[model samples]
Target: MIDVLIVDDDKLVRKGLMSAMPWDSFGMRVIGEAANGEKALEFLKENHVDLLMTDVAMPVMSGIELIRIVRKRYPDMAIAVLTLHQDFEYIQEALRLGAVDYIAKVQLEKERFEEVLGRIHGLILNQRRKPPNEPASVDQDVYPLDTAYAVLGLGDHPLVNGPRQHSQGWRVEADGHILLWTPDLREELWTEVNSDREWLPPLPDQALDADWRLVRLRHIAGLTQFDLLQMVRNYRQRDFFYDCNGYETNPIEKSVQELQADQPEPSEREIEAVKEILHAFRWVHDSQSFEELCSQLRKLRLPASKLMQLLYGFIVDWSRLFKALAKTGITLPDTFLCWSEVVAWMGGFREVAATLSGHLQLSREVTVSIMSAVKIAHDELEFPLFAVDVAKRVNLSRSYFNQCFKAIVGYSFNEYLRRVRIDKAREYLAQTAKPIVWIAEHTGYADEKYFSRIFREQTGLLPSEYRNRHRQR
Candidate 1:
């Protein structure tokens, strides 16, 4: 049975909630009750609970504060909020602090209450089975690759970008690229076809798929247990854990298998440094003062490359928090790809700081402005929708608008427009049997060749190849 705790300031309310539900039916039992966050903390110090359901308002400490404290202290524990109609704001804040669900205080009937309890129970069980840091393991005995050969050197691509149906095989990563094992004989066939690096897989109406830039290894015959282990080590440094795009249905199990001791824990001074940088980022959004923020960043006295890495790590940390807060998919721009290029393109750490601050302020008016602009641009993607056009609608200058948009949305106006169009093209390719020319035009491209070029640049696949691969999936 799952242990539970109830926290509310009102004594009668706490008692009523404790007795209101048949928690045992849902494999839960209220092990304790507290009248406020203070009492709850005291209880938690002496006891343990799988779940904590608390009221938003309380004396000594508010529920929001308690949730923050618990999130930092006991991250694995599930949390829920007790909220009245006017307390929804608190519930939102609670959820931002990692609350799993919220309960309407007035609707604590047995049926509704049991349903919510059951869900929390299931969530706890599911999370126990799959921690975020642990990779899913695969059985090599059942899926042997001894008779097959592998193709290596395919650069970063989506892990699940494979045919829907095929004989048993696995895609692995090595040397900062991907490898695929399958029954194969001709090593020269792929080399000759992709000699110019032009042809790709999943071509429209093609019965046979081509190897998409994956170089077949002639010397290495088949995959062994040692090969898989080495693949894990190769992937450990490829930032695969930070890249959120390739998690679903990924065959590579050890995507985040970094050596902990090698990755030295941030020293006490380093933690304080990051906190100072975060404070500066927060101050920028609050005061709209870029100079003061830059002054803070400059005070760190780190070189440009180290500064970029620090900023990148800061963004990664916040991205994780943003994902938790929004309970939605939030992928940062792959700007961490080349630090020198990103620093040069961003002009300095100041712009990078500003951009990250904007991303952190998702609930602010600045976010609303950018989102409105996105809606308008997406509505008129086929037309020549320019940044100036969006700025005009949002009542801001193009230059300032681009700055805020990049900060808040993590991409410039043109880059976002292209990405949105490409995303639409992906949808069309996957869902419809339209011709490549039709898809290109339908997604705002007048020339199919231009569209294909942009598509390859964005997705590493031609229109036909993407369509075929996604369609099969």
Candidate 2:
């Protein structure tokens, strides 16, 4: 059997890997577990292990250092990393250091255990059958093409005039933009070109003001002319998705299969929790609560698709609530490619939320009317309560009642009622193992499929999947 050693800082994670996985089924055995890279090295010195599955971040020696050492000491042993979505940079580094593959820590759910282990098993087997001197099946230096080149962009500045040639690279002007192709793959080369003030011409009385943009694929030796041009076009198209200051390392290039594989369906409960926190932020303006929201978001480790969905929901809801207060356009990109982009976008959103919250001014009468209407919707979930009926009950005209409800609740009366029923259905699904049809009927959804469709739209999960996720939690 293939012997495996698992290393992570968390005792719970180590224990989970040791006990929860069916190692024998994959023709592997968990021979040992370690809390950190240092401990892992110590264990390796005394034990025989064929596979090392390690986490990238730890207290003592990091996984990167451990991999570097282990690669030299035991070149034949297979290495894999346990990584979160945000650890892509570290993952790239590990892969470059000869890691065969990586397993997402979030994919350790019981249902996905076999699929993950099987993939790892296959990779290790492939490595064992390959000749040591042979290069990897696919060339890392050039990706999706044969030739290697690099793309560089220099902004309008006094130091750079039009397209200029360097000894290391060729430069040309395209569409009023400078495009440079270089075969140099060294980090220092890109760093100096992008940021080294010494490489730039000194101004007489001011600091250098220039924007240097570099685009390179990870593990690529260089980019081809076609690849460079394609990447440059992609960079321009996705300008809004990236931060303005930093050079783009990996452009937004992903296959549909890769995106679908990366996106994990978020539960209704998860979405609701975020909404609750955001709603609280809108009214109370509590810094602690907002910080907690950020903390929770980080902890969730949501993939870009799910994160974008959650943020889109928030923006749409907020836009409805603050329609009159909205002085500027609020929008979201079609998708986000990385966690850092999401964080940057969220920072801007925090400002928008604060600005809109400050502009909110609700009178006692409006507040009471809205609250009463909300209470009625909650109390009469099974009944078909129309907005007009609730409006009359709250002693307001239909139009006035709709305006107040949307302003206060961040959803239209119909939308709010639908959400209330779905939320009620979610409670039933989580708290008890009730039949889905029964739950649907009680939540005012006569058809189970209709209820599931609505639930999926709101939560990104089906009723059953949402229930299963809650149980796993």
Which number leads on lDDT? 2
Model 2 Cα lDDT, one tens digit per residue, 435-456? 9999988988888899899999
Point out where model 1 deviates above 4 Å.
86-89, 132-473
TM-score of each candidate structure, all chains considered together: 0.29, 0.40
lDDT of each: 0.57, 0.64
Check candidate 2 and list the clashing pairs: 148-223, 149-222, 149-223, 149-224
Clashing pairs in 1: 202-465, 355-407
How large an RMSD does model 2 have? 15.1
* Position 129, candidate 1: lDDT: 72
Query: Which has the greatest TM-score?
Result: 2
